[model samples]
Target chain A: MQPLEKTGNILPLLHEIRHALEDLLATGQTMVIDLQAMPFAPSELVELKEILGVGEVSAELHALGKSTIQETAFSGAWWIVHFNIDEKMISQTIEICHIPAILMAQHADIQMGLQQLSSTLGGVSL
Target chain B: MNQLSLEERLRLHGVSRRGFLKFCAATASLMALSPAMIPRIAAALENAKRPSVIWLSFQECTGCTESITRSHSPSLESLIFDAISLDYHHTLQVASGDAAEHAREQAMKDNWGKYILVVDGSIPLGNKGFSTIAGISNVDMLIETAKGAAAIVAVGSCAAFGGLPKANPNPTGAVSIDMIIKDKPIINVPGCPPIPVVMTGVLAHFLTFGTLPELDHLKRPKAFYGQNIHDRCYRRPFYERGQFAETFDDEGAKKGWCLFKLGCKGPTTYNACATTKWNGGVSFPIESGHGCLGCSEPNFWDAGSFYAPLSTPIGHVAQNAGYALAAGALAGAAIGFANKQKSSQAIEKHEEITVNDLIKGETK
Candidate 1:
């Protein structure tokens, strides 16, 4: 809760992530940067996000968990942070890709939703 | 001859104003300039004339040219290079023989004291026949070509530092361009074929500002060579934590540990490979899991085994310092006598010797 205290240097990590984004931009492949392993305070996370800066676009997902995904100023880069039911910080990662995979609706969920919509329409006789 | 400015060329090539501004921003960051300089860079580049560049290659493998020209696809970097009036380049020039020589002579004459002279490879001074362009010896050709140039860009380790050709013993008596041309303001871009973008970046800086960029002690553009690879390396965190890959196939290596123990010369070497990367910023040598060979440093070939640690002494030494001291003391009188005899022999061998004779040790 106190801005996650940073025990390790973050500049080198950011440098690596920048290069990973470069690869993603060129290859159209996605790169995931796992920040869960590092000891990062919530404060430090906030500071890092500020340093990364935000893009115009952002999205939120509420399926398996409450996830906030946002793009950075650098093209093809995204930061995703997950929160548990208690709203405590659980995991954080930076993804470099055209579009974040977490935002994609699962095929099974889409099919199930379609079937439910059809059943509702049938009952309503519309 | 009049040519379209860089901005005009970009417009002709369908690069939008927004795209040009983006490039300016990227270049500004690349040169370590603040974002505020973006507008200034854009303005400079917009009206910048494509200067005449004369490229000269001596005793090199053509890797430098290949790195700058062929590394990336036909991108903005290549487009800028193409936009320049490259008057002379043996490998790339279509003219051959007398026609090539005539073209070089004409370019020098036309852009007298105005053209940029970019040189790759070391100059061999062992003999006139060691290396030559057309009928002129390497040193002769270099001196002649350099006379009328405004500024010289020594582009690659060979031209900047003598490189492999100037290694210990130096069979061809190889020397860098600086050794020959002292009058010209020389900017060295030292790397065994420097990063493609670094080479282009230096050119862009020159085109933007009609003077050379700020230089380091080694005369390399400070923007690119200012930081050591070790300082910017991603594995530096591992190194700080006292983690290192002891061997190529070790667990640490597999886990992407620091390559310091595996003879990464990144600590001593200065270049932008770690940050800018290679092959479209995809991955540099360190990212590919190999230690830096420190190709950007001078005399890297004679620096010692690439596999050896930085802490290891480069030269062989006596097993015991005490024994070496004792041996030196024991042989002192004999060495003095031998020196006297050698001096007498030198006097007897040459009737009248000049400075050149002393330099070449040509008494006999």
Candidate 2:
């Protein structure tokens, strides 16, 4: 595919990300840009990722298929890509935050863990 | 699977909360919902009861069934089916003849007033003999089944809008489900065969909320059909710049220019084909360099030529579209063909060779 960069939409997106990163630093506000919602060419997506580059932290959650969460070269800006069981890209997002929400443990799961840990203890004190 | 709760089914599938959360996030994006709703969606689906679905096929090609069932493995539709009880589907159900008819009756008797009624294909009204299931007429069967249904889901253009059967010469006097079933809330999921994910999305919404999703004037889910294909089209830039592909394999075509002149119906048509896409996100029709057939809309088969510009509606497809335009209205902006003179002028400005050669190498 061609760059499809003729529209110059990439420049505005970069500016948006920069502004979002700034907002994160100043006010601790988190922003998520849903990549699928926008009309992005495949080549344009590649261009955006290359310009963002890779950062220090990267984690892959092997849950429903495989999803990767990686911080870009710019701190507080992370890229998260989700795939289905067949390993097709389903959702991709650029989140401006210290940590994306999917990484956090869910409350219900925590409660279930607590129950399991209690049963595992079985009269033994921690 | 039918007896198990969605929570139990997920437990059996070895899906964790994080995994389920990932699914919900993807679904939220698919439904055009914000990230904030992901948690709620997860909670609702995790504990959802298995709603029995009774599918009735009338005047259809069974393409809708094929589209939904033959979906890629571990898809949302597959998961939804695992969670719900598909009590009857004439095409998919193993039982046939009297056994199949009995199953439908038994399911209706069991879940009456609560089960979902999914109707595919148009309903013939010309004569009772035109279409029948076990000697029962289409209208009679629809009216009988709809009476007990909590809600009716009109799947495919046939069931939703009388499809091809009700075209210019509508032989069987075919009519859509909504035209007959008035007492029930009908959700129309239209397409020659709607994108599989969309049909599942509507089902998921109903399962999660215990109610139908917000619908458009056409009764299609607003989230999926709200945006115009042209607005979200990748070649929209070409249209804005007044560059167009006058022919299929011309210089402009190779350059990925706008297809408006080649008769794209993106401007007026509404559907999720552009964003949600089809065939597991491979590509949509426009991306493959064909005009939108507007198959999801009422009387789409009768719409102007798939090759004629949307503005000029005098071709084979246009005659059908003209009537709908009078009643349905809006043929979009009257783009002047005067821009044909500018095509050659823009060619001189292009200098870069595309990466098609590399793609050709990869194919080899």
True contacts kept of each: 0.00, 0.56
**Candidate 1: docking tier:** incorrect
TM-score of chain B of each: 0.86, 0.84
Query: Per-residue error at B327 for model 2, in Å?
Result: 29
- Each candidate's TM vs. the true structure? 0.69, 0.85
Instruction: For candidate 2, write residues B188-282 as lDDT tens digits.
Output: 99998998888988888888777999999999999889989998888888999999999999988888889999989899889988878888777
TM-score of 2: 0.85
Model 1 misplaced regions, further than 4 Å: A1-126, B318-364
DockQ of each: 0.03, 0.33
Locate the minimum summed-lDDT window of 10 residues in model 2 chain B.
Answer: B329-338
How high is the lDDT of residue B86 in model 1? 90
Query: In candidate 1, what are the lDDT values of residues B173-222, reduced to their tens digit?
Result: 99999999999999999998898878888887888777899999999998
Clashing pairs in 2: B303-B317, B304-B317, B304-B318, B305-B317
TM-score of chain A of 2: 0.88
